[model samples]
Target: MKVNRFGRQAIVAGAAVATASMLLAGCTGTSSSPTASADPNATLVFGITADPTQTIPWTTTSEQSVQVLSQIYSPLLTTNKDDQPVANLADLPKVSSDGLTYTFTLKDGLKFSNGSALDSADVKYTYEKIMDPASKASSRSYLASVASIDTPSPTTVVVHLSKPDASFPSGLTAVNTGIVPSDVSVDSLQTTPVGSGPYKWAGRVANESISLERNPDFFGGKPGAAKVEFRIIPDDQSMVSALKTGSVDVAIFDNPVTAKTAVSNKTKSMEAASLQYHVLQLRAASPVLSNVNSRLAIQCAISRQDVIDTAALGSGTVTGPITSPEYRSDPKAQPCAKQDLKKAKEYMQKAGTPDGFTLNVMTSQGLYSTAVDEAQNVQAQLGKVGIKVNVQALDSNAYVQKWLAGDFDAAIAQNAGSADPNTMYARYFTSGGTYNKVAGYSSPELDKLFADGIATTDTAKRKTVYTQLSKELVDNAAWVWLFTPKEYIVLNSSVTGFEARYDADVSTLWKASLS
Candidate 1:
């Protein structure tokens, strides 16, 4: 499931930026911050969770890859903190009256960091390549609305779609869909992607680090950090320690407790709601869980507040299917299931007189530390209602395999539906969704609602449709909604101009400077 796997990798990618020395330091503690570089712009080091799977956007799902690629390539658009689409590499596309065709105008005098002139041809080529059947772009389904591309002039590119899609602009803001030079081959792109962005790839040291230098000729203006080095530190605890010791200038902490540990007068921290949320997936095929009453009882049994307080360290919000709080502002949108043991017992009575059934809930030790804690908390909550849940924590890869195979009765995991509401909800609830295949869920009404939600550009109509969808999923007990995890970024006092993006994209560092 894309949600279970994809964006969560980025949590560690940005959070581990300040922990390079922690990996080498072992257990010997060093609480001192590193001395600031005499020249902040000369070099800046960022600790990342893991090395990117690949540098190219089309084939990779890792968030670390997206962070690296966001700096190497510029997308047609980007999103604000609210996830609203805004123009970046090009101005907003002018849509046809029928909404099937979009006309874009590129900025004047655009050039890649490699000195190649960038224009509409590059955009046409990149989109066409993604649309090709053999390209195997992970986002092909996301951008399937596009039927063909036409470049009428050097600065103008027109896209014809199979149908009208109001949320199409949001797809343009994806990091993997960045525009690249037309001449760069698929093989060349995998190794060294060239694009018109603020920075250019400089060097790579396998699993240790990846380096990028400021693009002197970039149209957006040269980056503040002349040289940026992203160091890989796999352990989260160590990463936080590195931030405290000043081995690295910046790091991201997924653990709020660890983030607090790194906070000091010399280092500052900011905690924001994450795009991803932890969830408990109940197997629809399981005879015990298949019953609607049982599912609702399970939902009512779990306490979101307890999970947040115990597992998340009070840094998260109880969430619904949408997860992101920004989209839940609508007055009519449905909220998550409230904790009601009375309701749970009543529903359990309807499910053939509850006599305590054992639910094996799986989790990943390597994914998020909170997964086990949340699972354990849920286990305790369900116990109160005569449901025994056995929490199983496994290695990440093994857990992913088990999850994809649908081998467990239940699983605790995290998923991000993307910034678009349609994409977010459709991914798990709609029939034949990425995660639904395992759950064996099929609903024609949900399919229709998702189809309509993406069909129109009208904000009011979209909200109404999604609000209904949320209520349906919650009422059906589609999944146990948990808390949206908080992402904490720790930065030294010397780093300036670093604004935290709602998503995991680290491209904002293009403007960041270190003292």
Candidate 2:
């Protein structure tokens, strides 16, 4: 699932200014050589910014949780480096000619971490739970097309869809759809998950750390690291220190300044383009934002480039709603690509608020390293257009609670984008989508666009459909699109074989080992 994932810190205005100045200084550091050959039994300590909100795979919308759960739970299908669905616990599915049914065959021998047999019943049960309304799974909307699951035999599962969905296999690749033993209770799995993944749950300390060990019963051979510990280090600088002191063998940094600092300290690093992007979501149901003109005023008032410069040290690309290369919308083509104070004021006048109005913008304090800075910059820009904005900076947990409940007039969010447009937007843009309430606006036209985007497997036709959808969203100011920040993976010199993925996934850590 595409959800919030970042370290948390209290809001401090001076932090942004300090980071910006450091960026201008052009920091550099010498490289270090590897000390020894890779060790398969070594324990790799991963430095993370925040603790996972929960460990339940299906119920969570937190990326932090996905990072941990992914290692413990194995999905029937997993995405390859190209972001295409590939076989994992089962072989590639066989699709019916009409595209409404999918048949999957389990591998010869599949066993959960606990040694229990995993079969078609487990796969069927997993999808059924996600489709159940009471489950409240964040990925529920992704599986909405599912009509029923038939387990014809212990090794085979047949899924029936209510309608044709070209992106269905990709949806199954998500961590939220990771298969589990049908006999395991949800309550037990929440704390002690059992699955057929490379690693098994070892232990966790509330907010300090979580550990995992190799799953001896895994179908896949032994992983590179025998044990992995995710050390929850909330402060970026502290995380850098941990890397320097050898306490953290690997870490991912969203803040360019901190990433540069780690490199300067002789740590090796790689930059990966992320599908995640910053966005300003306006609640169309709110009194001040009810009128499309009001939303347009806010969209035109702020500059996406300025936000990137101030918040991300200018290390990002301004983008619209979609970030996937195949169907990405051009930022230059967006109606409010360039800031126009005059146009903003005119729109405000048309909105019947020419004199001015106040809006509450909720943001996570240190979520994604620059959330507060982005909100503050937006506040200043909107002020110029006589749109008073009150920034409500909350802790990451509180911010997520409010964000999920649609509790604010406006919100600054870092949402995950997908390789497929439907996976990226359907949850928030479609009429029956799970997060449509959070979006606060939807129509027949918008829903139809989503339907068309997923109705066929034709790549060119799907691209055309998404292009129109992008236009509709930008034209109506559905969201004030911002920029996609560069995700930095910093590793100590002794760590090797770590590869980065475009989606900023850390699951590849299974292949990383200490030298």
Candidate 3:
């Protein structure tokens, strides 16, 4: 799933004063604790760049929403500090020898925030809802192989898969797969969610803040913080100011400049190497982009390093499709790692557009801090090879709707990577994938490689299969793969126990407290 980019500085610059006013208004009762001793009852104000569009766990692909939802909803499984799948709502599943069946037992005395008993029925219902086309879940593809689910008893859940999938267990650990009560209305869950997680949804002031209180019925005992408030601070500079003034105890910043500003203000910060990357997506179905040479030309013409340096202030590493260490493609192996205007021109000539061609690139203003900058940089770079790139900047909502509908010539996008290559790229590369249209291209060979990768449980064999798939994607110029930026979590000096995850998970806040 692609995580929406953060750091919308331009769009919210004028609203900074109004935003700060709202923050101050909301923080009247919740005081900061910069000099106080460790207090578990303190309200931990978390600053986020954007308001969550989707609060229903399975329906959203946004990282901002996932961060909040992860606290309100607990999945059957979750990842440990090492990124390995671990039990959450249920004990570790017992897999059959064939790897086609998994049996899970619900944790003893599990109960939702509403005081309703949670059992295997909720788990079964959650997975079924995700697989239902009506749900339009972003994670529907994750449970593609689930043939049927059987709840033999109140605590026992047996999942039967059509075929063997080595990554199946890990897929269940995604935040989107969080369990919801079997009887809960899907529509109501968006505003009023009920789960067995550490926190319960208290209230939300649209576009201003979201509040959560500790769940008394949580199976995981008591959460560290009594209350958690997620304040929507659209402007990065404003977030830095909030950190400096002790208005916000913790905030996540994707913009290196903003992060540096926060740190200079005496805030404690840690940088986590995230599995998130930015990409220039060429719609292969578009008239000009349909030609492989044209896509290849665009890929060869742009310098990823230049984009990183200018847009991200050199705070990222050039990356390929896969970000996981074991199966990642070597960036150096990419054809145009170093700009090749000569080769670019040759491809353009082969594309039957030797003189010049106009390319319309759509980007979101105030979505990602560097979105417009990156697009403009590509526009300038592509100009050297006869491509006239027109950069179109739109609001985040418009951009997301258009992008998801595959209504674009090209787009500048930020996407989330996964520990398993199959879990990351399968939905984009498979013929029947939910995002196949958005991806704009797929072939039998690519689909076969994806199938082969997940069919085996052997790590070495899976790595070899993914290596081939990665090459195929780059060789065909699936998307202009850019760099993965480091995500910074800035905290007040008094905040303790918060640890950053490689995936930029904020659920660790359940253990965080004010010192």
- Give lDDT tens digits, candidate 3, residues 1-515: 11223323333333442343233223211224556666767888998766777888887666678888988988898887667788888888999999999999888889999999999888888999999977777788899889999999999999999999888888888878999998889778877988878899999998789999999888877787899999988777788889999899988766655565676444677766677789999878889799999999999998999887666656678998898766787887777878899999999999999997999999875456677778888998999998999999887667777887889989998888878888888878889776788889899999899889889889899989988898898889989999997676778877777777775677667877876
* Candidate 1 local Cα displacement, residue 66, angstroms: 3.1
Best candidate per lDDT, number? Answer: 2
Clashes of 3: 0
Task: Give one digit per residue, the lDDT tens place, for model 2 in 1-515.
Answer: 11122222322334653564345233222223456687888999987767787677776676677788888988888887768789888899999999999999999889999999999999999999988888877888879899999999999999999999988888888888889889999999888988888899998898889999998888877787899998888777788788888899888776666676676454677766688878999889888889999999998899988887666666688998888878888888777689999999999999999977999999875456778778888999999989999999887778878888888889998888788889888889888887888888887899999999989999899989988999999889988999987777778878766767775686566777777
Global lDDT scores for all candidate models: 0.71, 0.81, 0.81
Best by TM-score: 2
Q: Compared with the true structure, what per-residue lDDT tens digits does model 1 show for residues 1-515?
A: 11112122324433343352232122111122366443545677888766665677665454567778888888888777667788788889899999999998988989987788899999888887776757756555556678888888999989999988776888788776788888778788777778777889888988789998888877777687888888877676677677778888888666655666677766876554467767888877776688878888888887887777666655577777774443562312333256889888888888875765778888876555567667777888999999988888786556756776678888887776566776565545666454465554548888888888888878778778777777777778767778777676787767766767674447667777776
Models, CA RMSD each: 7.1, 4.3, 6.1
For candidate 2, the 10 contiguous residues with the lowest summed lDDT are: 1-10
Which pairs of residues clash in candidate 1, taking residues 3 or more apart in a chain or in different chains?
15-252, 16-47, 17-47, 17-251, 18-251, 33-245, 34-245, 34-246
- What's the alpha carbon RMSD for model 2? 4.3
Q: Which runs in model 1 stand beyond 4 Å of their true positions?
A: 1-41, 59-62, 111-117, 128-137, 283-294, 323-326, 329-336, 345-353, 356-360, 385-409, 417-419, 432-442
RMSD of 1: 7.1
CA deviation > 4 Å runs, candidate 3: 1-36, 264-266
Name the TM-score of candidate 1. Answer: 0.81
Give the range where candidate 3 is weakest over 10 consecutive residues by summed lDDT.
Answer: 22-31
